[model samples]
Target: MARHIYACPLRWSDMDAFGHVNNVVFLRYLEEARIDFMFTQAAEAGAGEFAGGSVVARHEIDYRRPLVHRPEPVTVETRVTRIGGASLTVAYEIKDTAADGTETVYVQASTVVVPYDLAEGRPRRISPVEREFLSRFMDEEVVAV
Candidate 1:
């Protein structure tokens, strides 16, 4: 399966007094990556409707290691874990890969997102187009957060 990869830059302000990236900021990182995947990339594939409206039904995250702010961007890899009738689960890993091919994962998380009908003011089911787009990034191994 393919994964949507985003290079997320770390800002100095994202660091906590203790010097590591604050736990809360990781949520923002996830949002940035998710928006790129569901909105930017999906839109290019004709599933732009997802950009119109979507709600985060739930978020589950596990902070595996402390991440300090650095000049290089961290990699956030996103994949589809489960796609339901009205919602879909996307899993993510925030990590750095060394030249030696070792990976250091700082966070593992998943978010349940529901498409919404902005005009109707309610949640909507996944359309065939959206489902087809999401299926391209499907993976069986979901991070157990």
Candidate 2:
């Protein structure tokens, strides 16, 4: 399985008055993880490099639990679930791996990212390098528990 892991140190500002991470913060975390993953692939595989910019076309998140900001490290697992002609779908699982296992899922999310020619402001095809990098994580069967 192609898995991209990003450990984020929770910020004090990420917490809400309710004593847990605000719902919106989770998406930011996922986005960070996706960036880390793709960049890592670019460095390793030497192909499928995404030199272009990305835009989110769709997002779906399922919040499974609330986690308090402990200023600790949290892991976000990102994978490419699908790649379309002009878009890529990234799925993420956020968990407090320090406190619990994958069973302690804090949040689950999927984002559809489309390539954009920044200068032209138009949709573009996935570059050969990017497509190669994303192929490793395409529509896998093993679900994160």
Candidate 3:
């Protein structure tokens, strides 16, 4: 399986009173990674399949460690874990890289996204092309959060 990686910058406001990234801010990181994968990478791979926007039906996240403010960007790696008829599951891992190149995982997350047709006001099935595109990043093994 192939994982799409996005480098998300840390903002000063993301830190909380404890001097670490707030729990709520982790969702933003996952959202950024998902948007980059679906709207940017997948769209560029091919269009017309995912013309309509997707909605998050569910989100699951597990925090392994607190992320402190850092000069370097945090890495978010996303991959398709399951592809259903109208919904797909995306798994994510948030990590902070150290100066020596080591990485510390901060969180593990997943989101269930449903493709929707705004004009029709309903969820739509995954087209063959879209399925193929998603398959490129599909992981056979389940995420071990």
Counted clashes in each candidate structure? 0, 5, 0
In model 2, pairs of residues that clash are 47-129, 48-129, 48-130, 49-129, 49-130
Runs of candidate 1 exceeding 4 Å displacement: 141-145
Write down the TM-score of every candidate.
0.95, 0.85, 0.89
Candidate 3, residues 1-145: lDDT per residue as tens digits?
6889999988989999999999999999898888788888778988444546788999999999998887888999898998888888998899967889897899999999999998898888887778888888988843222
TM-score for predicted model 1 compared with the true structure? 0.95
Q: Give Cα-based local distance difference scores for all models.
A: 0.92, 0.77, 0.86
Better of 1 and 2 by lDDT: 1
Residue 70: error of model 1 in Å? Answer: 0.9
Candidate achieving the largest lDDT: 1
- Per-residue alpha-carbon lDDT of candidate 2 for residues 5-84, written as tens digits (9 for 90 to 100): 78977888898888889999988888778667765556567743354567889999999999887856888988788777
Question: For model 1, how does the per-residue alpha-carbon lDDT over 17-119 read when each residue is reduced to its tens digit?
Answer: 9999999999999999999999999999999998999999999999999999889999999999988888999999999999999999999999999999999
C-alpha RMSD (angstroms) for model 1: 3.3
Between 1 and 3, whose TM-score is larger?
1
- Tally clashing residue pairs in candidate 3: 0
Per-residue error (Å), model 1, residue 112: 0.4
